[model samples]
Target: MPMSFYAQSTVQGTVTDAGTGQPIPGVNIIVQGTSNGSTTDFDGNYSITNVNNGDTLVFSYVGFVPQEIPFTGQGRINIVLQEDAAELEQVVVIGYGTTRKKDLTGSVALITAEDFNTGNNVTPENLVNGRVAGVTINTQGGPAGNSEIRIRGGASLNASNDPLIVVDGLPLNDPRDLSNGSRSILSTINPNDIESFSVLKDASAAAIYGNRGANGVIIITTKRGKKKLQVSLDSNTTVETLTDKVDVFSANEFRSFVQANFPDRVDLLGNANTDWQDEIYQDAFSANHNLSVSGSLLGDILPARVSIGRSDLEGLRKTSKFERTTSSVSLNPRLFNNHLKIDVNANLNFEKNRFAPGVEGAAIVFDPTQPVLDPASPYEGYFEYLNGSGFALNNVPRNPVAQLLQTRQIANVRRYFGNVKFDYQLHFFPDLRAVLNLGVDNSTTKRFEERSTQSATGFNASQGDF
Candidate 1:
């Protein structure tokens, strides 16, 4: 073999960012095929010894691409690294701004439409029930009713514990003022139209909204137009029935108890046996449908999505019902070769509701021995107590069946929510951008209550409208 001698020399170099030209500290610099490695200091300078001039040098760092350079007898070498787009992926929205998940230190969870729960869901919260950690969703209790969504639970005892709700950059109100019953906070939005939900569970992530976000923040992003023409329809029907009845005294059980405990009180029991709860509760059916048309328009420059939805929800309690109609128009278009992006969205919703009164108490306590109907009684033939003048008493509880059958409470609500967002990306600097957002939320509600002359609860016919 021919005699060969290789001299090991030290290589010193400075590493900086290619885009900002700023020094990057803590960068890993290692000689290829060897265990010798060194890290850049605060000034982005590093030195590696015991390395031949022909050996390759590898520079690696987080959020930046790695570089491999060969030393060709050069005493000093300088290298610039470009950002790795894959390592810096955009995370879900946080306070209307976005960043990489690795850079975020706050507790945040994102639920996309694909991860949502399936069924005839009545509210938007129902879609995310039990899907995300540190988030709890209490679904609607009745037809199109309200639900309580808590992020990391309540933080305060005196103030509101409800999280601030933002839909398409517009914050939604409590919705208690939107209808007579103030049904659902997210009832205006069709569940099928939602694209994703970003939940901020910690104080740091929700700090952008100030005190209103003390409980947390729920950001709802609806679907946008797609490039190709697409038509979507989501329809489902749900039937609701009482899972189980309360373990209350039955007709026979009540009579036997009363007779055994107090013989004198036995006179209060009647011959007929009635189950008040059975008479008040019934099976209910709800139907919902959403139709959407989305595609690119204006020579593929403007993409738009238009949707219409309708829901008819019947309460498990007899004579209670809710009906809603909603329409939405969304446009997301990029102009000037993708420099300017515009997001325009408008949503309109109309609702009609018939509220059921709190009569379950009377249903459970009402005498099970009395017959529901009396032919000779003056109170619409519904049995009731009579005084000396044969009039229904004012202080006594009314028949549960009679109350639900004779009373009518209705509300008509209309709401319009719209928002426009403009984002401009600098041509010179792709990472820098400016954003402007404008929004409006308008609502109107008309409610009325009417009761027949049932000679109970109220003796005369009464009506109130608001």
Candidate 2:
């Protein structure tokens, strides 16, 4: 029988930092070109079995340069790892330019999509909340609302304290454009398309924009296509309810308290004891869906992405609802050996807002003894107060339930934003490049407010457009 020469050997070694000379724990030791691997123990000692003379061993650790060594019949081998300066000097996007983190002169925070919060994020700001230090994201108008981002607090007294948003080399709309209350252009952007966020916190990094960057600057880079075709679909739904309800008196408690305090006026109380807070508030629901496809084409890479999203939200108050629909398309193509690149992006958003009247004030002040519906009154089905006459009583505020049903405030907004950018690198000087960008942002808003003749306010219907 022929003698078998194949044999396996165990290799043991310790890994240490070159500069500190301290043992580095959790170092990964892998047999090159094979699935076998091991990790260093607390003493930085790693042992791997089944090692051959020609086999290669790979040692790797975070923040340390990886090293590969051939077994070469050695049973014990010790290795020192040098710190990876390149990993520490990652690239950072600044205003009008990109710089290495080691070369940066000002405070800047970089956040990528991978680091974004996981959940049903409806807006870009929602993805950034609580992730970056010194960045405060204040949700302005409840669920699916716009956010106010302040880096290191407000710097301006009268001017807009919100950061200047630059998306894909184009300046976004004015942050102070809150014409629709708490809705802003940032809410229109699809968070899935975002690749990274770079926040310039100090003047040294944001001074390039002059006055516009006084409060700071947020740079948003959208995702680009990869070398291969890829498709992704994401969908989620969210249910929301008021977390902290006002600690007001319950129906029975309010009735007994009113009877005890105002004994003479006890007759003023209605036959029914109602909970106005419960009647006005409700559980709100919202959902979102996104689909994207990206790929390269021919010699040149052409990536096109289209996304559609919708959100329907019901406020704590009845009849107070906000619905928004957003659709966006981005096309990017590289030509001339990637020297010339063109990008075209278009976004359209439509919103419908129905606001409940007097819910904020009347819902809290309306008499709890009054029933939700007054059957005998002319407004028989609605909750209202009336004397012998059919008209609404003037002494007290309009019934909260009647106010929500009889009065209506509806706002419909249609907004469009489009931009085309061309970047061409000079053939003569490969390092030099020129860019031309043109963008348009337009919005139309129409508002309709009507107070029914039965409403206590008795205001005529009004319509306005902007």
Candidate 3:
């Protein structure tokens, strides 16, 4: 069987200049403000279907004027776009001033905003991963975790090895100040807030920072609101398993090793347990949440921004847990016809670390096979006397329950950091801006551990804070 459809009417159009009456070649004709439309051929003739009575057709041309014509259901329309001569006068912001790309003396690479937003990355280091030629970013192990970046090559050895970090013409706080234990302070920042970042590598480009610029400098510009208020949201959740676990004896192997080696020491031969490493590590989960909103301050009062972030990490160990939360707000005020500016940023972070006895020392030596010191389980120093073959001559098994119940440990660290800046532009060298930057950072960490009377290390406990 054959199916047939028929068109009862046709819609047609021709576009021409109103004054000259000459056909406008290659004109784009579309239904007004809708996805339905078509373009005119070299002869400026176009036709469309599916438009009912009183439907409107829009005609457009790139260089000429643009206009819309209403259809009496016949569907013929024309448009004219005025020549926008002002397009040629556009000036791009380059370096300290505006210049055409052809007129620039230095080589600079620009990354489109679209590419930056659509990238699959959890940190700024990851954002630039394979895109740059001379830059390299390496992650130690986990996702949404710390990354090590090297531009060209490393410069620092021990003290103050990190490259300079500058924001809005203000140098960042010393990298050495943030080295708590072994972690870097730069890891605390969220990559999503960055609008763009530029790295200055050559000596000619980095000389401005003077002595501190030897290692190179990175400039980070955070996002700012535009005319029409816009809001964006970001959230990610990651589940991580241990990439590598310690290789050690299993429960059966450990029992066999103990029984074979400590036959003479019946105490140790009778009470062997699983390797401690197997009991401590576990699958971990982490999550990140971020929200931000930016818009122009009404009538040039001030540009303000607020952001909040939180992270939760739970390790595989049943008794081990770690978590961190942080919040920050920033404001930039322009005064005196944008000649003078003041910027202030405040940030706070709170972390809680809780640990239990399993991962620590001493608790590992006790054997679960031996009778624990519970009231219901009778004391059994007698069975410890039973001799077994392949036992070591002098080895004693410690009580398992005393080792589990006797150890306790906990620690917490709190840190706060902030900075303020004032900048004044010079009249002679308009490109020259002098800035006074001040910052403060402080952290306190406390840890405590206690061992009960049965442990061999009890004598060392009273000595305090090891």
Each prediction's TM-score versus the true structure: 0.78, 0.77, 0.55
- Kindly indicate the candidate among 2 and 3 with the higher TM-score: 2
Candidate 2: segments with Cα more than 4 A from true spot? 1-89, 175-177, 180-182, 387-390, 459-466
Models sorted by lDDT, best on top = 1, 2, 3
Q: Count the backbone clashes (under 3 Å) in each candidate.
A: 0, 0, 13
Q: Per-residue lDDT for 57-86 in model 3, tens only?
A: 666664465676666645444443454344
Cα-based lDDT at residue 315, candidate 1: 93
Identify the candidate with maximal lDDT.
1
Q: Which lDDT values do the candidates have, in the order given?
A: 0.85, 0.78, 0.55
Model 3 lDDT, residue 184, Cα: 40
Instruction: For candidate 2, report its TM-score.
Output: 0.77
- For model 3, the run of ten residues with the poorest summed lDDT: 377-386
What count of clashes does model 2 give?
A: 0
Tens digits of per-residue lDDT for model 1, 320-385: 998989999999999999999999999999988888887899889888888889897887899986
